[model samples]
Target: MEIIAPGDKFFHDIPEKIINDTRYMSYFKDCIGVIDGTHVDARIPVEEQAAYIGRYHSLTQNVIAACDFNMCFTFVSPGWEGSAHAVRIFKHAVMDPKYNFPAPPPVDAGYPLQRGYLRPYLGTRYHIPDFRRGHINAE
Candidate 1:
């Protein structure tokens, strides 16, 4: 835990990647890190395999992790069943004090908008190509 601490102290400064990139400097000036989840193969007893079998029909564990722009891991929450939804794991990480997830700044309104974090609305199509062409389709 000493090597991996999660708080503003460890991420107070804007990353160099964003600072150097004019396109993201102004927009993501305060951004700290990126969070995501993925499924990794897991080994378990035969009797417990069913619970781990996910969409890929293989035993796996869902892992939630976060990393700064420099590619350093800031937080990692692993061991969730592969069948578990990403939202379920993410909510637990945020609600559980033990995780000590860093809090982001506040936003006025939107889905998944918490005191310091925000996520894109689920089920909304967000193709960058479409956006680049100004053809965003309302969901």
Candidate 2:
């Protein structure tokens, strides 16, 4: 996991292109990467059915991954129960000293914006579907 899961060094070391990109420069000035949760289909024993059924109503494992602008996975936390909320998984992860997730930056209005992982401002549209639908094609 260390080979791909970046250490603290990566937080301060982002590419020039990503830093200069107008799309990210302002809001994401200190952000080194992005984090997202995903559900991976899995087939588990009947006894574990209740534990693995995800929001989509299927057997799965919930995974949270952090990646750089280049789309390379820098950190991947898998094996959480499918029903687990992404926030819960993240909270548990950072609390574990062994995992050593990056420390968050200074508090922002009582809400500590995660240090290296830049969460979108509340109410901003950041859904994947929004990006999938091209602006040129949207009515």
Candidate 3:
């Protein structure tokens, strides 16, 4: 709410702002986001501890997450068991059909699949922050 302000438009476009953000581009090249998990130190409810308890570490219930270049939550896997491995958690939580966020739209005739990734002749843009200068470039 604080960042979105009182009445910011939903479809605000700011692609030109990041077209050549060298630092942000260099830091995040070939990476859409960095993913990780951290334990939140809270004892599970006594009744729920049976499932939440980790076999090895046995002390924490974790909040798994994926953070983008701006630290926005692209994905979050909360209430997960304390012992879930990164890959297992990522595979299930991020791509599970239950998750609300939509996956990337499938490519059609214009962009052929290459090396198991989509390559397009052109692309659309979005209103994203420019971290190169540590400020928002709205235009």
How many residue pairs clash in each candidate at the backbone level? Answer: 1, 0, 0
- TM-score of every model versus the real structure: 0.76, 0.72, 0.49
Model 1 steric clash total = 1
| Candidates ranked, most accurate by TM-score first | 1, 2, 3
At residue 84, what lDDT does model 2 achieve? 89
Which pairs of residues collide in candidate 3? Answer: none
Error of 1 at 125 (Å): 6.9
Off by over 4 Å in 1: 1-3, 6-11, 109-111, 121-139
- What lDDT does each candidate get? 0.76, 0.71, 0.48
Could you give candidate 3's per-residue lDDT for residues 1-83 as a string of tens digits?
12211121121322232446775665333344344567665577787676666655476676766544455666566767777
Q: lDDT score, residue 46, model 2? A: 92
For candidate 2, write residues 1-139 as lDDT tens digits.
5545655544666556667888967766666666788899888889878988998799989998877667777767888889988888887777797886655455353222454344556655576776777664333
**Deviating ranges (above 4 Å) for candidate 3:** 1-30, 47-51, 54-58, 101-139
Q: Which regions of candidate 2 fall more than 4 Å away from where they truly are?
A: 1-3, 7-10, 104-118, 123-139
The stretch of ten residues in a row with the least summed lDDT in candidate 3 is 1-10
Q: How close is candidate 2 to the true structure, as a TM-score?
A: 0.72
lDDT of candidate 1 over 1-139, digit per residue (tens)? 4545554555667788999999999978877777888889999899988889977799999998888787888888889999998888888887898888765555454325555565776755564444667654665
User: Relative to the unseen true structure, what is the C-alpha lDDT of residue 134 in candidate 2, on a scale of 0 to 100?
Assistant: 65
Backbone clashes counted, model 2: 0
